[model samples]
Target: PAVPAPPVPAPSDREGGRDDDTRDKLKQASAALDRRDFDLAERLANAVINSASPPKQRAAARLIHGQVQCIARNDQEAAQIDLRGLEGFRAMKQRLLNVCRKHGILGR
Candidate 1:
């Protein structure tokens, strides 16, 4: 008998598609933020922010976006993004608010 080749994965299965990429980017963005690599975090988050990703991914990106802005002392922009994206993320909302409050921003 001849040896059989393994079947290739379809587009939907390849790297789990764009949603996965969005998710990966969001994870990388968050990690980069935690690592204090604000520039890379900003770039990753910006990619997800500008992409047509799901709301959750965008929300996560927005969280990162706000955090980076805060680190950069862009209080106004941070407040805007954090407050808007905090809708479905209760814990994150509070955390962001606390961080902003600590920095004397306090989103409107």
Candidate 2:
């Protein structure tokens, strides 16, 4: 009798799945932001934004990234950099807000 092999684990079951990694990265970014490490926070938040997660997670990641960008803008010594960062935050906020509104998650 031929025995069937065991089925492989789904993509979500892999170690550090997409959602888990995204959430972990978001936490790391938040910690970096709290420490005033704007550069590291931006990197980590961007990682979460670029992760292969669902729309809700992506929106959350964008919000975090926008926050980091806002912090960076406040610390910017150059006016050009500050303006650019502000623009980036506005765009990210708008995009995430649209997503949240569509999903009915914008209002409590």
What is model 1's C-alpha RMSD? 7.0
Question: Distance (Å) between predicted and true CA of 43, model 2?
Answer: 0.4
lDDT of 2 by residue, 1-108 (tens): 999999997656664576788888878877887788978877886776566766655555556555544445532223223233334456655654454444443323
For candidate 2, give the lDDT of residue 57. 59
- The global C-alpha lDDT for each of the candidates, from Candidate 1 onward, is 0.79, 0.59
Pairs that clash in candidate 1: none
lDDT of 1 at 107: 46
Off by over 4 Å in 2: 1-12, 74-108
lDDT digits (tens) for residues 17-92 of candidate 1: 7888898898899899989998999899889989988777787787788878776656676567666876988777
Q: What is the lDDT of residue 50 in candidate 2?
A: 67
